[model samples]
Structures are given as structure tokens and as C-alpha cells.
Target: MAITSIFNDAFVLTWDFILTIVDAVTPSHPAGHVVPAGHPGAGGEWPEYVSPGEGDSRCACPMLNAMANHGILPHDGKNISFKTMNETIRSTYNFSPSFCYFVPNYIARALDKDYFKDTFDLEQISVRNDKGIEHDASLTREDVRFQPDQGKPHIPFINELLATASGKDTSAEDPENALMLTSDDLARYSAKRRTDLENIGGKLDFIHKMFGSSNSATLLRIVGGHVSDLRPFLIDERIPDKWEPAIRSRVGLTMARFNLTVLPLEFSTRKHMKALAKAKKSG
Candidate 1:
């Protein structure tokens, strides 16, 4: 069934915050009614498909079932997309979920309400080929806010706070500013990150700096994205003991995900982590 996002005004956004929000889909849904999983098998996926624009070859009808399931399908209205989904999630949450959960929901939430189509059963849709039987590949103007006269096609980043690192020139997208960290900067960033995690008080930028970048916190901030930056802590499991294994597992998964090079490599996405790991997307 199409699900109404529970992340709406949810003060407590744990991994479930995103698990409940992202429609049960992944960048991996080959030859059915979603983005064709770039690789050929269940084990295959473009690791680089992590960022937006790097690869977003969706089925054009990305959320047909989701729309029908929610009874908010857009064909009667329009269609859902990154822009539309971002708007949908934003219309309710005001901020993206941040970290790995940040991007999917950001893209899922961007669409205007009009694109929220009615849902349908997967069994009913014909999927004999990669494109499916009759899904329209053409995106309507309503689906995307296309400029009549193009100067430059500016598709904004869904997770503006998301820092991309694809071995490409990031100078144009994200300019590097030398940060002089004083004791004061450390104190502030440290304190803020703690509060957000413990639900006392905090700032998202604190998490951003830990990731070696500085950006405002939004729903699209995927804490998992920054896992690579935490080297020593993971080497020693420095996470606070009071945190539940579930929570610890989440941090570990986030770390493991971005830190894919680590040893004892996990062989499955379905195991060895918290439910939250499912929410993390490199993008």
C-alpha cells in the first residue's frame, strides 16, 4: 500500500524515521517498475550510483505503485519524482531527514502533490522487458519544472547538504573553504552533535564537520555518508556504551557502508546491521 510518511513532524527521527518514510524501494530494482539496477544481479549495483546526477536513470514511472498505494497517485494529478518527493516530504517535515536517509526522502519528497499517483499491485503490471510493458518514458512538464527557454539546465541537488566525492571536479558544485578550527569551534560542534543524537539539543553542521565538510542540517543529511571520516573511532568501537546495540549497529552500518573498504566485508545488505542501515544511501 502507498504509505503516508511518518517522518512528518516526528521529533524522534531514528533510523526508522527513514525506514518508515522511504517507499520500500532501492536504487536496485532492475527490469521491473523502478530504476534498472545498473548491475545484473542481486549482488550487483553501481557503487558510484551514490550521488545524484551520477546516475538517476529511473523507470520514468518510478512510483506508480507507491502513488496507487497511497491513493495519492498523480496521473489523476501528475507524477512523483526527486523534486516532487522533496516537496512532499518538505511540505510536511520542513527539513529533510539528513544523512543517508536524507537523499531518497529528499528526492522522494521533492515532487509537487500533483505527481503523487495512485498505487497498484506489482503482479498486475506487465514487466516482460527492462522498460516494462507500457510505462511512459517521457516526463511531462508538470513532473519536472522545465524552462521553456533553456539558458542552463539547473537541476538542484536534492540533498544540498550532501557532499559528493566521485573522483570528479567538485570545485563547481562545492567550493572548499579552509577552516581554522579553534578550541571554540571544536567545543561548539562537539556539543551540538551530542544534543541532536541524545535529543537534548544540537546542530546538524556539527555532523557535517565531522564528515570533513560544513553544510546546514536538513532531512537529507545522511549521517552514514560521513562514516568514512571516522577512522580511529571505528577501529576501536569508540561509540558510547550506553547506546543500544541497535543504535551501535546503526552507527557501525553507516560507517561500514561509506567505509566499504574495511575488512570482514559484509556479504549481504539484508544482514549485519540495524534497520537504519537500510536507510543510508551514498547519494
Candidate 2:
């Protein structure tokens, strides 16, 4: 009974689940703010044997993926606990350009939500201070954050994109199956990317703009910009033909970030219908 709602629906959500999802979906990093609840400080890695540092037990840490993989209650109605699932998250993830933090939230939701018997109302989610500025100075420290040995200046970008980009920190022993998911599997996973973008488009758009500035452009140039894999629909062709060169200047973002746009109209409409039917029956 797999469940997926590209929108942020709040009906089936429990208090704990809703609180967690709220923090996960509305990333505070955009506001350059780090509240007591969560913060992405650095991209540190453990060699897997050195006394199994805090990373070993951090399934519920702020990064939505880690929290999803580590913190959420298992939906299988079994005794699956964070102690049991931490190893899986360490091994199930990988790093990539389009590998935004949103994927883990999707996987985590799947694990927590009762997909078969439950439905969510996507319109209920809300955001604050959505003026579209990336990395709100109010939330960030002007002081430098620690960076990995990887020689990149954008600590958060590197920590996020390069550090746990794969979402997993450990590698599978089975080389054949280690990160061996097919494009089909990736596409299925990739859908989460779109769902996440949709969930917090306002914040993400601002972050995308921040990265394009001269100071940060080089950082994004590597993984094709922060929001590199958007669909053609996301492309803003209206920039004056003259500024086109400036606005559409980067390499990775110059092309459509994604291969396609939203889920097919038919499927989306059908999902909505199914949701309505379920809602009516419940009412």
C-alpha cells in the first residue's frame, strides 16, 4: 500500500509526524536561520570503524532524510526502531546534483504514513516570510562555518550536495547492488525531488536566486546549480532577450533541470479523484 502526495496534505498527519514534517518540508536554511530544532552545520564523514561517532546514531537529526530514516515511527506495524533503521539510512543514500534533501522526507513519510487507509489534504501546509530571498541573513551567521577538506567555500552546499548527496553515508558491500538502482528506480525516486520543490517552491526559488549571484555561482556550477533539474515549465523565457545572456548564463541551469514536468495530468487528476472519494466516504 504505497502512498504518495506531491502536495503537503495535513489530514492524516499525527501531532508528532506533523511537527516533524513541518520542519522537514519548510527548510529553515533558506532563511539563513537555524532554530533549536535543526541545523545543517557541516559535512563530516566517519571511516565506519572509528568508535562509530554520533553519526552512527543520528537518524533523527535535522536533515529531513536523516530524520525520516532515523526518527520517524516505522509504518510496518513491526518493531522497527531507529536503532534498527540507522544502518539502512547510512547505506541507502548517495550524493548527486539533483539529490536535494527532499528525497529523504519522501521516503520517511512513506515509512510513517499508512498509505493504504490514509489520505492527506495538500493545501493545508503554510510557510512564513516567503519574500523569495535565499539564505535569509537573519537566520545565518556571518561567521564562517567549518568546511570539509574538499576545498569548497559553500559549506552548506557542499555538505548537502557532496557530503550526503547520496542520502547515504556508508557503502554497501555488494558492489553489484551498491548504488546500483536503475534509471527507472531513480526516476521513481526522482519524483520526490519534484514533490519537494512543489512543497516549498517559494523558499527554493529564493535559494536558487542566491546561488546565481557572482559570489556563489562557482559553487553551484559544479552540480548544475542548486535547483539544477527543473522541468521546461520552470524555465523563465520572459527575461528580456538582452538580459537572457545574463539570467540564463550558467551551464547546468541553462538547460531544463529535469527531464519532464509534473506528474501526468491524468495521474494527478486520478489521484485527486481517489482522494475526494476517500474524503467523502470518511465524511
Candidate 3:
């Protein structure tokens, strides 16, 4: 069934977001027919012969099904389930839930690569095949952008920022004008990082610094894409008492969805350390 997207807002929608929404809203049949799982109708299970670029090859379709099953996407509208979607993701990616959950992220990345083709010449980018040697690959305009050098500055970084702000002749890298910080300043900064790592509130603040406010759209999209799987935390009673307030506060974000999406690895590391210590004591 052809699905029309209602996401026409100013928010930048990633390709995965579009696909997932489309899958969720689209009826199984044009005639609104619902087929059994193994039936040979439009609502039947996904076909077995799906090629890499067509039909079930796209990750978001299965994710949409998962969302529907978990009540994240309304089952009445699309009627797919998280279990069904999870099966498809596992079959396609051959990965565990932790890995398969990132399918939307992979899709977003691929779309980003294709989107960048318009800004940079993909023909200039060299890619290596299975042999580990670089080759031109004879890319077409329709090909995903393979420009590895795109991260390089077109001009000096400071100069570009200066041009945008004002035509200032000042350069930040100049040692003569550099302001030196004391040892106490460095120690205070290190102490603050340690303090942030010790609690959920500080960790959230750190996450905000990394990807929040104006730049939180991408992380939010990832969280939103997997809302069915992530939303359990909003209601789960097992979450640490100290972290409850912080998690609950951000549940209603329009574009800054899940806190876990931007959570630092150090948080997980701390948990691991605690577990290890507990095991050592018990053993």
C-alpha cells in the first residue's frame, strides 16, 4: 500500500524516519484487505526473495512493524509488530537486538552519504573494494556520496568562523594573544568531569553539551525510530531512583527524544565496574 507522509514540518526528517512512518500508515492492501501471515495476499508475510535494494531490504519497514507491535506505532493503522520487525532485522543484519536496533541509524547514514553527493563531487572520492585497494569505482550521479575528504576544511577553520561572525583580522591560534590557564583551572575542569560522571543529572548536562538544543535532531531521530524498544524505560520501575527525574523530564521532547541515545560510554563503564565489584565480593 502506498503511504503518504504527514511529516511536513520544519524538522529535518531522515530517510529512515520517512520510511518508518510510511510503513506504519500504509495499509496492507489498496482495498484495505488484511491477509494472514502465510497467506498469498498483500498483507501476507514479507516475501522470501527480497533483493538487497528492494522490498524488505530497507531496515525501517521491519522497524515500523516492531513499533506497531509494541504500541509505539498504532497497530490499527499499520498492524505490524516489534517481534515481526525484530525477526526481519535479525535476518537481514544477522545481529543481536543491540545491533539490530541500530538499523535506522545505518539507514540514516546511507541517506546522508547520498545527500552529500549534491554538495561534493563523488567522482573525486576513492573507495576500496574487498581487496583493500583504492579505486575510482566509476561512480554515477545517482550513487551515494563517497567523498572521504569532505571533512577537510575548504579554508582555515578560524577564518571561516571569523568571516561568518565579522571580518575580524584576529586569529585564535596565535600564541602571542593566547590566554594561559592555571593548574587550578585544569584541576577544576577535571574534577567537574568526574562529578558529572557520578550522577545522571551531570551526565545529561554533558550529553546536552555534545548533542543538544539546536543539534539534537539526529540523536532524537535515532531514539524516535526505536521508540517502541526505548519507551519501556519511561515506565519501568527498576530504573535507579536517582535517575528517574532526569529520564522522565525529557520524555516529551519533540526532537530530542531519548536520553540514552546521547548517553556517554563512561556511564555504562561505571555500571560495569559496579557489577564487577559486586561479583568479586559475592564470589
Residue 101 displacement in candidate 2 (angstroms): 20
Q: What is the lDDT of residue 165 in candidate 1?
A: 26
> Candidate 1 vs candidate 2: which has greater lDDT?
1
The models' CA-based lDDT, in order, is 0.25, 0.25, 0.27
Q: Encode model 3's per-residue lDDT on 1-283: one tens digit a residue.
A: 1122123122234533544444445443222122223322223232332112212111112223332333323333232333443344333212233333343332323334332122211112222232111222110111113334321212232122122221122343554323322222222222233333343332333332332211222212322212222222122201111111111111122222223343433344345446554665799
* Candidate with better TM-score, 2 vs 3: 3
lDDT of 1 by residue, 1-283 (tens): 1344554324324553453334234332232212122311112221111111222222222222222223322323223343444333222222223333444332233321222343322222322233223211111111122332111112232111122222222333333321122222222332333333334232233223332211211101211222221111112212211111111121222322333322122212113222223334332
Which regions in candidate 1 have their CA more than 4 angstroms from the true location? 1-12, 15-41, 45-102, 114-283
lDDT for model 2, on a 0 to 1 scale?
A: 0.25
Report the lDDT of model 1 for residue 113.
23
Q: What's the C-alpha lDDT at position 46 in model 3?
A: 28
**TM-score, every prediction:** 0.20, 0.18, 0.19
Instruction: Mark the 10 consecutive residues where model 2 has the least summed lDDT.
Output: 237-246
Q: What is the lDDT for 277 in model 3?
A: 48
Q: Write the per-residue lDDT of candidate 2 for residues 112-185, one digit (tens) a residue.
A: 53323333211111111242122221111111122211111233422233222232213445442232212222
Candidate 3 ranges beyond 4 A from true positions: 1-44, 49-112, 116-255, 258-269, 277-283
